[model samples]
Target: MTALRKTTTALISDAAPFAIRAERASDVAAREALLDACFGDNRHTRSCQRLRDGRAPAEGLALSAVRQGRVVGTVRLWHVSAGGIPALMLGPLAVEASSRQLGVGAALMDHALAAAKARGHRAVILLGDAPYYARFGFSAAKTGELSLPGAFERDRLLGRELCEGALDGAWGMIAPTGAPLPKTKASRARKALLVPRAA
Candidate 1:
């Protein structure tokens, strides 16, 4: 098992309480920095990134664990089809190293999953330690036949069905299923000025 996998399975017992909320525009830089600190730049090259590339997170599914106004942890669920079954992909759950033993990572996972369920999502998939994610109900039992667009460890692919039997027959390649994120006003304004002129 990898060092990360070991760390994930450590299971901190005293997780300090933190406020969970929807991610905001201003949180982007901090969130990216946090992810880099935890997962490094290599995170973008992972197989799961293929599903998230150019796609906005599932509506209202990106979240942050904040402490005293600082973004201490983060987690997001992206829209994906688990073998044609509409589901969310949870990933890159990270916390400040100093905050690891305090339970921030676990809190973030719980918050993200609950939020996904509240949004009516039926299932969630991820590639991580089976021993760690199993605590939250994710497992390889239902994901044995599912595959990612890029190469990945078959054993690391895990999933959990929020609604019973959501993954009963789910099998095939996982594909992006989300609508493009809405353009911000600033982006729209820039595009409006770049409109082509007719001769």
Candidate 2:
């Protein structure tokens, strides 16, 4: 196994610095700032953010990498369903520009993924560079059935199965969890036509 895979296994087996922990709401500001610095202001406009908006997985799964009391990197997983099958979405992983080579980002991802597996989340989907994420077993082959709203490099949409065959038959347009589609005037008119007059 590669060092990254080995470290990921270790995180799952031992609750050390790489162990997954609950992210406190207090950590949001700092985490967001780190992400902003990494991805810039337009980050929220990305399709991944739409998948995360109201359905970020519990803070406990929002893992971070801290060094000497500073949050050097972070990773967040969001709860989502693919083809009506529940799965997790991994994204916006960011490391401070100055800390790029320190393994903080990898550690956070390893810890969060192990935690997801332990918690029974069977699969994870993410939009990111295939070469980098492939080290963790993420691949475009598994995401063949999934789709996104905005234009994206098809190979960039990737998936990983935490359990054997977890993504089989999983396919869908990733919609916001708990978010209702916008009510259009035409739909409202249809609804009005269906209702009986009030007595």
Instruction: Give each model's whole-structure lDDT.
Output: 0.84, 0.74
Residue by residue across 5-114, what tens digits does model 1's lDDT show? Answer: 76764543124456778988778767877877788658778899889766788888888988768898888899999988999999878888877777878878888888
Question: Among all windows of ten consecutive residues in candidate 1, which has the lowest summed lDDT?
Answer: 9-18
Positional deviation of 4 in candidate 2, in angstroms? Answer: 32
| Backbone clashes, candidate 1 | 1
Q: Write the residue-wise lDDT of candidate 2 on 1-199 in tens digits.
A: 5999999977864544433245654666667778767887688788787676534354457776765566777887877777777778888788887777666677878888888888888888899999999999999987888887777778899999998888888787865553343456336534643565444
Best by lDDT: 1
- Candidate 2 residue pairs in backbone clash: 22-60
